[model samples]
Target: MRGTIHVLNGPNLNLLGEREPAIYGHDTLADVEAMCRAEADAAGYALEFRQTNAEHEMVDWIQAARKDAAGIVINPAAFSYAAYPVLDALKLCDCPIVEVHISNIHRREAEWRSKSIMTQVVTGIVSGLGVHGYALAVRHIAEVRGRTK
Candidate 1:
């Protein structure tokens, strides 16, 4: 099998470093993308980096991953707690899936943070570690790859 991964981001995350620096930290989205690409490469994996502010686009990408990739890492951002469409697409894929969040949703205000509709479909979730969550999720993906070895 090809050890490929698709990193998908959604809704306003393009403003990473500057968007609420207290919550999202100082790493820009491009900065994090570079980190993810390098980390995936180090883990012997190929990557497909994608980002969109539209929920439908993210859903479409996840649906496409069903036949096109080996693993998936998504930072659905505000959509995580509200995106049933994204969850629906994830449920269609058999590949290993991980969700990423730059902030700890559960610790935030009830209205500002909410439960993930897609959590049940993911093998694991990484959040609140800021940009490092991406690389850490990559390691977890590598570990899953390790087990199947």
Candidate 2:
């Protein structure tokens, strides 16, 4: 059976496009969702795309995905630095996890911003790739599952 891929976004990502055009590019979250949906459809996987500003909510979704999803693509946003609970929840996922960052966190001015706790638990990461990162993550999950099948 084909499985669902959960795409989770955190914190200020809902304000994409208008928040910082220079760093995040001009694509809105809706645009990113459309792109991801199209990619998931092409791969014959159901997409469960979600964004939240609350840390607890993000963690809850991650826990939910553990039961229902075949894989996960998450952009933890500011939570990448200190969301230990989020990282812990992600550890429960048995399927592949791909972490995404729209901007190159390594190139950011703040040293703390360059770190991602999620990297420890994820299968791979897509950074500095703009909105296209979501599609890449979805495609990767699809490809990996395809090979397994």
Report how far residue 39 has shifted in candidate 2, in Å. 0.6
In lDDT terms, which candidate is top?
Answer: 2
What lDDT does model 1 reach?
Answer: 0.84
- TM-score, prediction 1: 0.92
Tens digits of lDDT, candidate 1, 1-149: 34788899988988888888987888898998899888888888898888899998898888878875768999988788878988889888887899998887778878546588778899899978878998888777877876886
Cα deviation at 135, candidate 2, in Å, is 0.5
**Which stretches of model 2 miss by more than 4 angstroms?**
none
Candidate closest to the true structure, highest TM-score: 2
Relative to the true structure, how large is the alpha-carbon lDDT of every model?
0.84, 0.93
The local lDDT score (0 to 100) that residue 51 gets in candidate 2 is 97
lDDT string for model 2 (9-28, tens) is 99999999999899999999
